[model samples]
Target: MTRSLKKGPFVDYHLLKKVRSSDVLNKRIIKTWSRRSMIIPEMIGFTFAVHNGKNFIPVFVTENMVGHKLGEFSPTRVFKGHSGDKNSKNLKGSKNVVRKK
Candidate 1:
């Protein structure tokens, strides 16, 4: 769900304060766990280390990312394989010629 239009985008209070105080050119790398926070226009060109459960993922903000959640850029789950069980047989149909009696 999106935030209320009247309240505006929901940005982290601490993150907003830091962004406001620092110079645009000397952008401070921000590490945050608040993935629900929205990317504001002021955040463009800034680098953010967004937490994705295990580690922090570096994200460089751009104009295109505005109004989106910081979490959208960070991935939580990783899909390694389609196999359901490790101990289960992977091959359904295969030749067993070597076992011929």
Candidate 2:
């Protein structure tokens, strides 16, 4: 469910303070664990270190990222592709196999 429009976007109070104090010219990374916080217009041009479960992943905010959750940019899970079957390896080593249309 989306947040109530009347209440406005949920930008963390502490994070907001950090954004306010940070200088856009310096390009400093503002580390934050507020994954639930929404990205606001003021956050554009600033780099944020959003915490995943294990570590902090850097996310540079841009106008296109506005209205999205901070967590959306920092993925929590690692994708290790599907495992190949035992026969798949043998098939790869054999180049003489022929295919019919």
Query: What is every candidate's alpha-carbon RMSD to the true fold?
Result: 3.9, 3.2
Which consecutive 10 residues in model 1 have the weakest lDDT in total? 91-100
Residue lDDT tens for model 1, 21-69: 8776886688899898999999999999999999999999999999899
Candidate 2: tens digits of C-alpha lDDT, residues 15-69: 9999999999999999999999999999999999999989999999999999999
lDDT of 2: 0.94
Top candidate by lDDT: 2
- Which lDDT values do the candidates have, in the order given? 0.87, 0.94
TM-scores for the candidates: 0.77, 0.84
Give the Cα error of residue 20 in candidate 2, in Å. Answer: 0.6
